[model samples]
Target: MRPPVEVSVLILSLSAPGVFITMNNIPALQEPLPILGMGMVVLGLVLLLLLLTVRNLKKVDPLFYVFAGFSFTCMVFLTNALEQDGFISGFMAFYLKMGEPHLRTAYAVMTSYWEGVVHLLLFLTIIHRMFRGKSYRSLGLLWAGSSSAIIVHIPGVVIGKYGSNIQPAFWRNVPFFLVPFWAASLLFSRPREMPVVTADKIIAEQKKGLLSRPVDLLLSLLLLGAMAFSVFRGFVVLDCPLDACFTYVYQYEPYLKDPVGFPRVMMLVYLFYALPLLTVFIYGLKTPGCSWMLDWTIFLAGAMAQTQWCHIGASLHSRTPFTYRVPADKWWPVITLNVLLAAVPALLALRCHNNPTYFLKPVPEGQTINEKKKN
Candidate 1:
């Protein structure tokens, strides 16, 4: 008899391919897209022009601009929810089919229901802002949530184009990918780095150096560790060989190596965690008098915490196959690390909030504010 593992793999082999890759089930085919996609863009732009020309568009928040730009995003969400097929669901399905099957399934589920919910609420919020001419208090949460969703989706589309039957040609599927990012950029645009109070000034104010504070040192190091691990794990997701020390931690989960979970999650980790940590180190903590960087950091902590919970919860759930089950023995490390990922940011945010002078130190001498804004 074949080994039990081989039998299990063989059994899964029959059901695995094309979990969400059915051409016949295409949503656009079911309900034509020309009027929906490009037409909506034209209409949205027209309405946007009207809103800008007639109304004080400046009164609205930046995220409102994203919603206005992605005017038909509600329809995309609705189409996916109703028909279980649409541009987003279809394109992501095709893309994920090339790599891990679970990612397609996850993307489909997220786009279908989760997206339906988010897009609807996001639409309402935008309408509220436009009509009411006021922004919601939950601006930070809105930015973090919307940005994280698009952040995860990007790596899937990018990596899926490799080695799959999915045509690598642009233009064919470019709109679906570009639109999300364009919206995301609007939602999370950063301000120009403000000039920092000089170190002499900080000393004059009797504020301690960022690293001198015990709490700041600990939180900074904690985020540093998370960033390093995320990059190292990216190598694992990319199948870069690692020596024993690294694998013992990151390689614990078999399903993580599967395209669906680890790869998608890592994309967020790299974009959100790794890069932000470096930014915080350079300007947030090291420099003085930056904008309320701590406020954004706090919101990110909550957002990432929620994201990890979703990733971990979904992975262990029955939807994923036994072939990629997370080993129970390895559970603590995963959960603990993610919890830390979530908590450390909050702690840093708290630390900064409590002592603004420490976290918002002045930018380095000769650093131009407009140049920083361009970033």
Candidate 2:
């Protein structure tokens, strides 16, 4: 099936020059913006001021300065989103044209809003807590998970669809892609601020069966449903031959079939990564002393929230070709299902956080006696 070497070489030679020319001819391209330099200066000055003036901030993790600086970019994200929607203009004109042509994609627009609103608030909250000498490991992990998901999917889509159009400035995402991993490792290594729960409380909470806890039972069922939905959508995006998949893709979620590749990659992510987590969450709810659920639930909630926000918004946005956008008649049902999918993980995180005794390690009888003797 291989083509002749001469023919293959000829084809590539012919196409490469055109790709370069197209990339260089981006509409509205202008002289490079100073935004990047300005941001670095601003963040550097803020960090220096904090290190000198704020005694509490000096004791905080160094990454706190980085995040505190990154939070300022959230406003830039909001401006980009507004410009993309035509409510404003010129804010991101040069960047969009030369820096990241892929930002024109519907998915990127939604992601911008998410970073601007949700991520901004998260960073500010963590910064405030850090300044007050409070533990913010949970919030930092949430941000880490959310930012990681966004960084992964956005670049995947860019290379998937706009590989030929990539410009030099696109490489600026290198830091964005790398920093989350560092931040995540640092946050995970931090000591958790464990809640005060007596031995009796841990024993009582862990002793209860799943059926005895109505909320947990409901969450288990909802997570099972989410797992199934994730699989079904994975099939839809993969172009399964089943009647349901065919009908669902065309009539309900045409965006899954878009050639842009974001939706397809996103579904695959859900199927491969999220499905296993959902099953484990169900197990965690039913079993006692599943301490991992507390942290993982928050992490999963952040991932699901970020992914669903971008996916749903992209599916409904006007930029999606009319043929690929969700059908008007199916809009409400589709939105409801996707919204609930995103909400289930959030609820699980809340349940684990609010009453974590069930997820805590069971107290050993000998250890409890030793503690009593010490008292």
Candidate 3:
């Protein structure tokens, strides 16, 4: 069986002793959950049919379906949770039912609330926006938040299913895994409209001390350093030798050999995160008055916020392999630091984007160019 989620070692978890890590545990139900799986199946089919009947079906983007599919999965899990029996229907019920063959970690249980309840609502909001042709600014948060909640959980299920003979109720996860990808094609087919700027909508909020003087400069420098560390971490993940990275990485940090799931995704995300984010921060500092800075910061904030959440969540998750667990000695420091990585960007984004005038170089009042007496 795949050992429970917890980062116990840097590269040694594969052979580390299994010890109880602090994860939320779930108890197994002696009997099947007190509900019918088939009923939900019928409801899903009916919802799909109803969606298909829309008059503008041709104009409907596939992202809608991705949203629908994930929402459906969320609903099914909600059913399991609400029944208070951890039961579900269709193929997913087998993997998701409250008991063994599942990791039964708190993260797994929380997924029910995140996917089944929160994601369900978020998808509906996104769909409402899509239909209304609203700006995607709000969508930045929705997409990242939902992605964080779900993406972090994926490696857990994958390792559980493949590492062990655990079924994972794979059928239940089909739409959750595939829908966003298919929808991405549709999303990128055209250029996205940027948020409209009202030139220098400076407000008292813009004068907030956080965005003034040395504070902004210090924060930018700090963010760059953090991103640099993130890049180094990614390198380690992509196979930087332990001897080369030992000084930086905890001795007990887990790195699976040919690691799959969370470790793999993390390495890739770090590479993506490292350089561009640093460049963004640099560009903002160098061109303090740049208009595009606000938009970039906002989007990056969403991306970082969720990424760190997923990273930390995966590390603490019960399904995490023992070999990969963060040793207890470094747990608080590591987890707390990652938490900071998420927070700094979010706060910066809020300060910069929420008030467009927050970072612009203010012109002196009553200033106009003096006319030169030239002949």
Candidate 4:
């Protein structure tokens, strides 16, 4: 007999595909077919990856693997239903079909609810492991970040809104800001007795080197660019009037009947934001003792990508006259790449048995490193 988890995942997967097929009908029937098509293509790829992961559940983090598979299934199903039927139709269908509407309202609702569950679980896992023997500093960083997410996210939930209206984009992104904030805090918080070399030791040499002046400068520049773009977008959202000379800027306005330009710009923002994380991952791969970093980074990237994917899929399904620019089929490819990218690190993390140093460092004295490292 198939494992209980596998059987559950299969059921969820099958239910979701039907939703996806239906969701596509909404946007496929709209104009700007290419844009919608690309979106769907990306979405489909993501679902395929999740389905594959379910088939290989033994290789993934039990909590995350299950959540990921279910999350994608929910999204595809919701999107399909929303696109084919109206919002109420899709929402009711998934609610009744999946037997979990109370857990989440719509496909996007399911995605957000599960995503929150996953993050909380990850936070707990990190904390549990850290308490076992890992550094308080790393745990502290995660705690701070996760706590920020809770703070920012709770307001949105309480207010009963999904997107930026509950918490503006700037406020919604505050959790991500915690990473750099914590990094800076480390420099000041390090105990006088702690050696600088140990910090270097924790990270891979390649990453250590990449965090040097030039790389730091590049990161700073990127941050600044992101901030500037955010400010610009914020201003536009606020409806700050433009002078005659700035009339060109108004051409890129976001509140127009057709806001195609806004999404395109937002896509650019996502790409830029993703770059630094990607850079760090590349650096980790080259670092001697930094394999764990690679795993963590991969997990984070996948989670983040999944978050975005959920939003995009939801947006396509909304009843607002706004363009349903993304086609249904496109989502598959994007999700597939995201899963592969994330799985590498997750498998590595599991194989290392939660030991960050297993692949890079020799076993510690008196115990096998992996066993010793278990939380």
What local distance difference test score does each model get? Answer: 0.49, 0.76, 0.51, 0.39
Candidate 2, clashing residue pairs?
none
> Candidate order by TM-score, highest to lowest?
2, 3, 1, 4
Q: Which lDDT tens digits does candidate 4 get at residues 25-124?
A: 5544333334344435644665576556356533433323323333443344444444344454433342223222222333235345444454434444
Candidate 2, which ten residues in sequence have the lowest lDDT sum? 4-13
TM-score per candidate: 0.58, 0.84, 0.58, 0.35
Best by lDDT: 2
Worst 10 residues of 1 by lDDT: 8-17
Alpha carbon lDDT of residue 165, candidate 1? 34
Report how far off residue 18 is in candidate 1 (Å).
27
Clashing pairs in 1: 196-362, 196-363, 287-361, 287-362, 288-360, 288-361, 288-362, 289-360
lDDT of 2 by residue, 1-375 (tens): 654322322233233223323434554334344434433454566456445444542255687655755565566667678888998754566667656777788888898899878987787677667756778899988998788776546546574677777766666566778888798888877767677677887788888999999999999999999999999999887779999999899889999977777888888889998999999999999988888898889888999999999999999998888998999999999999999999999999999999888988766544542354345
How much is the lDDT of residue 373 in candidate 3?
Answer: 12
What local lDDT does model 2 show for residue 229? 99
TM-score of 2: 0.84
Candidate 4 error regions (>4 Å) = 12-76, 79-82, 85-217, 241-249, 253-375
Model 2 bad stretches (over 4 Å): 1-58, 365-375
Better of 3 and 4 by TM-score: 3
Q: Candidate 2, residue 153: CA error in Å?
A: 2.9
